[model samples]
Target: MQREGSPWRGLGVVTQKELSDHLSSARMLVIQLLVVVTGVVIVLVSLQQIRDITAEDPFLLLRVFTRSGEQLSFVFVMTLLVPLLAIGLGFDLVNSEHNQRTLSRILSQPIYRDALLFGKFLAGLATIAISLTAMWMVVIGLALSALGVPPNGEELARAALMLVVTIAYAGVWLALAMLFSVLFRSPATAALCALGLWLFVSILWPLLSGHLVNVLFPPSATTADALLNSLSMHQAFRRLSPGALFAEIVTVLLDPAMRSTQQSQLAAMGLALVEPGSIPGAPLPLLESVLIIWPQMVGLIGGSIVLFVIGYVVFQRQEVRA
Candidate 1:
């Protein structure tokens, strides 16, 4: 029998309830605190290093995020921490409902399974957006107060785009965690699988992609064609990892001088041979930077949607018995 009424009838109600629960949860609070504290310390450290050259740099505000002191840059730190936050929020999203025996009860009401799943995802994404926005604001306020320099319109626009990209990056991991949550009944199993995948993709994948490329396409003795092919293949493999995509997007968005996302040995050689008239460090227009990262943005958002759809299919098929 066809279901009656709209599938999204109670989406707002479910989203509101889930958002409330997430906001009040101690797990979320602790995660947010950890991200905030780490970001602030890194920003402060980087600010000290950037202070001396404030006059020389036109985009000092952007530098606050991309510049690192002795540790990681704020942008890199976010790349690492945002996934953890996303996983923490979603690793138990569906399993916890099953464990508490609330899945059937919740669905037995006027709510459809569609509303419930979508609402949970929207709530988690919103929570991440809120946290990242607050972090960005804090960083901006600190830059303004410490450096007494205001950002130009273009700098603000670029930072805003970066914020949007970061949230999309978080969504990819959140959806993956939720997919695992739907697959496994045990929350522990779901969380472990999610974290393990994250570790492999974020840390191990980049290291292995080059080796895998070399194996797949051994360099030829006489020509650079095979070497170029290997380098291209390596980048393609790296882009499969969301972390690599996020890092590339952030690098270009934060620094307008960045011309391309190509980081291979061949790309470095190509850059060295650029014409003498080429301006290497000239800032790119905001639209040009967006064009550079448009594919990466699509990849992150597309990955999230694909993962969420898989989880939705699995959730719809599974029986929710009380």
Candidate 2:
């Protein structure tokens, strides 16, 4: 039988309900508090270091986000924390309804499953976006108060792009958590699976990429070009993980003078120093930096969409009888 009306007939209603629940939930409160507290400490530490070393730097505000304190920069800290926040919010999204025996009843209403699933995902993403935006503003405010200098137009633009990229990174994990929730009936199992996958991608993948690259591209002693080829392949495997993609995108966006990705920046700069007429440490135009990391940005967004589609299909096929 053909269904009537739009698949998104009650999308707005479902979104509003879910968003309200997410924003008001105790779980959200804890996650936001943890992120905000850690972020503030890291930024403040970075501010002190920036003041002492780079007081005359033009991009002082950006350093507050990229500079490291106790070996942890705000950007790196977000890369680690964002995934956990996403997973916490999404790990039980669908399974909790099933465990409560409410899934069937919710479907019994006029709303289509499409709207229900999409709405929940959107609600989760919006919550993360709001939290990140507020934290970003707070960090900027603190930096301005300490450094006594406001960010220029380009610095603001770069920071905004970083925020967008971080949200996209969160979406990737949120979709993964929701996918596991749809696959498993128990919420604990869903959360465990989502976290296990995160550990593998964020921690283990980088460790193994070099080994895998060597196995695929083995060392070639005869040709000088062999090393470059191997390094490129290694970077390729590392970029498969969403964490690496996020790091690469922010590396260039936060540091205008950085003309190379993390993997190649040091080597590229060394070469520039020796080569006559080459300008080392010169900041690239904002547009040029965007162009360099554009592929990584696309990869992060694409990964989220792929994960969401997989979950959508699984949810659609499963039977939810009362």
Candidate 3:
């Protein structure tokens, strides 16, 4: 809607152009194909598994997101796919223009750099949202046709909320990728940096956290104070990883039976013993599930914002001389 003289004149046009490029890009198409193909395969196998496990389970639709073949759940698959897609979409967003000697030309237009950066980021996120929606609907439709079970209101609500969470989760990676795009001149290097960070945070952080706990608190000090300290330290360190945060959010949302986030395992067992007669396997109400995951969502969104702000500042100050 911006006019000729406005600084934001080209924002919408640039966003649409980028959106069209993403929709038509071969890489984007391949990523979406992989997601849909794997999702379809997983949902097919999971349906049979669910049938064998429980016929009258109320949350069968919800199970599609968390259940999969050979210990590879759909949510887990996204832990790999989402970040890769984000990185691919953004790793060259800025520097490629510089390499091609087009950045200054774009900057010479009646538009600010903010519009360009924001537009590109928004376009990447829109791509994620669109691709996720397509695959999510496919899974839900197939689950409905195969399972022959009607999803209740609550189940549908949970799925919708989880989709929103998926977009937000993708946004974090998009922001990080954009940050790398601003930092690195070479696209390959930016991608490597993002992928390396993802690998370390997802794989190595937990092991390091465990080692730290063991080194600081010996097995001999398994008493109350040391155990509490160790648990707190592990929690503190794990929260540093966005993957850990996203996983916790997915677990609580898709698994409606999840009540508390930080409750110790021993405390949970004690509570179970005390409430033996209470309702078993009951899903939490929708509002309560949102409340339980509020902090997780906040952390994720805040992390994305911080990364985006850093990218914004860097891009603004970056010398665009080509």
Candidate 4:
């Protein structure tokens, strides 16, 4: 029979402890410092450019900020800095506990293994979400103050959607790091493995895919159509890389002025673009852009969840002693 009011049951205790630990750790301080440094740099760069521009429309200023920030600021932070931060926090989560012999004592408690793992995972996720939200607010505020333009309803909605996508992308890295931590006994080994995986997926995978395509389908006339057929496969394979997915999502979300210039082009390319007459039109709807990214987001997050579940099951079944 389950107790009605007990707080230390199953996963709750684990979640609470993990959250407490994260709150007290140097990990929190490091995350804060990174966000501050990155946000300040973005603001400074934007301000410098704003001074050089002659146009003074607030809306135009806002648009400039969106374009420049999306291309230079957000993409760099999300792709490079954020993944490193996530790996740093998670790469040793399990190994550190094991090294300190705390795992055996924790398992000796009444809590279930699932609870312990779930709590820690949830805590890590919460920390990520909170950190991201803070940085997002800073960006929005800086844009508003510097540009002197309030965000329209659609702009606000798109900002929210972008933030969610960013979090999901970061979560993939965090989960992968956790999986590596559980698989390896030493924290250093786990960290190295996680970083290696990140580098392969984010940087090397694209180059390898391009090389394979060149070698296998060498752009001959007969193979030209074959190359077109292989393009989708290449894209699908590249989608496995989170960096590619994140880039595609950012391209769609940040550039709202993209629409088909003409019906013929739309029919030919199978993508809508900004009409010729609407050079300065409102961006595509937030939901529509998000829909474009749905497949990539699902693939990355689904892969992460699958990996985490496998790690969880393996960790739960492993033997541990004091």
Candidate 5:
């Protein structure tokens, strides 16, 4: 009874169904409205700041936009927003189906379990992309109107890269949410667990790292400089968190110039330059900064993919009752 055509036929059909369902959902409308409103607020604030600065300068708008962009990039917003949105969207993905007694009927169709999961994941990702894209457009338009010129080619390229990084960052949370949805019988439990994980990674983990380092090496005058010269517990803790990784990546991409600042500090610290002249005065290249962040991006994205795959496998094998 199996069709002899493409092996992905079932997957395609499920994806279509998922997309259709998402498009018709009221949730999408509400999310879009919120994103638009937030974007407008950011632009208005930036414009007001520009007005408060030296008004006669032609480059005033550019300076203001650059400063604003540095402060409110896509990555920064995604770091804060992705977990909440992903958890809300996915915390009940499976549990609700079972609660409504629809899981049995869905499984009775020709679609494979893998297809169902894949479809749902793609649909959620699509929703995130749409919301982010709309926000980015609004920001860009506001920048253009306020600045009186379009963004340069390099700036545009960076903005596009920022968007991609944001989506990938959101993927990590979405996968985690899906995993919890499959693992927990109650949607509320899944959402709470997701929030707990977010708090641990974003806030508690860094605080614990700082406390542990202080305890391990109580600061002496000499040891103070040495401890400061050593790895930054803050940076190390940040590297441990996906949100921090996302922020660093966005910063590096948007302002490639900051690479020099990072390199200078690293050189000064790596060489134990307590006197500040132990290392040469050469600045770091933009390429080097990009190279440093590339591994971090790979790690975060890979971790997200691995988690998603694990969740998918677990969900596929799960026994659902009507």
Candidate 6:
């Protein structure tokens, strides 16, 4: 007979121990320092351009998170660097235990593999959470203190949403790193694989997306067919890369005047929508903003869960010693 609480037994202990190790580790410190440094640089470098542009802005505080007109934005920095941090934390998560001759020993205890995997993943996520939270505070604090403008209620709510979106995005990378850690026995192999995925997705995927889109939607089609094909290709291509999905979400959240799509709505309202891009207008309500990017948020969160589940299944089926 199975014990009633045995499945979840020691879950908390394992999570706490792993989380503590991550928090106190030198690696975490270095990653966090990198985040802090990058955040400060973006804020300082873009501060002037953002100031010049948003001089009359009501939501200037939120601009810190989104403004990258003259330089890379804060969120952009995260998109580039956070994945590396995640990979660093997770590339060795499972394989290191095996290398240390501890996996079999740990499983020989009462703890379920379920608990062990969940605990370790949670710990890595917690470390990422800590890093993100600190960076959020530092970036906003510097912006507010420098600009001398406190965040309005709407700004606060939107910033919170942005943070949630960011965490989900980071989780996808963390899960991928863990998946690699599980699939590859060598820690270096896992790290290199994860890093390779990051580079290809972040750097090469978009270029390929463009070429593929052009090849699939040639100029010979009718105008209406071309437009439809273009729109469909754009959406499909955007969904292919988590980077594009995240960028779109952040753009809508941070820049209130930014009205990228919704041409029909503008046309219905008898507004002259700009041809190049939607003209700047009053910022959308928080509810409206979230509704606009809800699909992207779901894609990011869903992708993370799917990756995590794959890792979980692989971990469960593997020979305990491996």
Candidate 3: residue 62 lDDT (0-100): 88
lDDT digits (tens) for residues 257-285 of candidate 2: 76667434436534332325657787888
Which tens-of-lDDT digit does each residue in 120-173 have in candidate 1?
Answer: 999999999999898888788877888888899989999999999999999999
Estimate every model's Cα lDDT from 0 to 1.
0.87, 0.86, 0.82, 0.72, 0.71, 0.81
List model 4 lDDT by residue over 1-322, tens digit each: 8644333356766777777888789989989888877766776676766666654442343443354543575565578877887898788888778889889998887766777777777888878888888887887788778767667776776677777877887888888898888888898999999999999988899889877766876655545345445565566667778887876676566656543212222345564444477554566666766776677778768877987898798787777763
> What is the TM-score of each predicted model, taking all chains together?
0.94, 0.94, 0.90, 0.83, 0.80, 0.90
* Count of backbone clashes, every candidate in sequence: 0, 0, 0, 6, 0, 0
Name model 3 segments beyond 4 Å from true. 1-7, 217-229, 262-280
Cα lDDT tens digits for candidate 6, 1-322: 6655566778899899999989888998898889899778777876876777857788888877766553576656777887888888999999989999899999999888889988888888888888888888888888888898777999988887887788788889999999999999999999999999999988898778877877877646656556555756756785688887887788778876555543333444465445455335656678877787888889998998999999999998999764
Residue ranges of candidate 4 with Cα displaced over 4 Å: 1-8, 47-66, 69-73, 221-231, 258-282
Please list all clashing residue pairs in model 6, or write none if there are none. Answer: none
Per-residue accuracy of model 3 over 188-258 as CA lDDT, tens digit each: 99999998998887778878977876687655675766665666677777878887778778878888887
Off by over 4 Å in 2: 222-224, 262-278
Residue pairs in collision within model 3 = none
TM-score of 6: 0.90
Q: Look at candidate 5 and give me any clashing residue pairs.
A: none
Candidate 5 lDDT? 0.71
Each prediction's RMSD to truth: 2.1, 2.1, 3.5, 4.9, 4.9, 3.9
Candidates 4 and 6 compared: the better one by lDDT is: 6
Predicted candidate 5 versus true structure: per-residue lDDT over 234-273, tens digit per residue: 4665577888788777766655454432443456656423
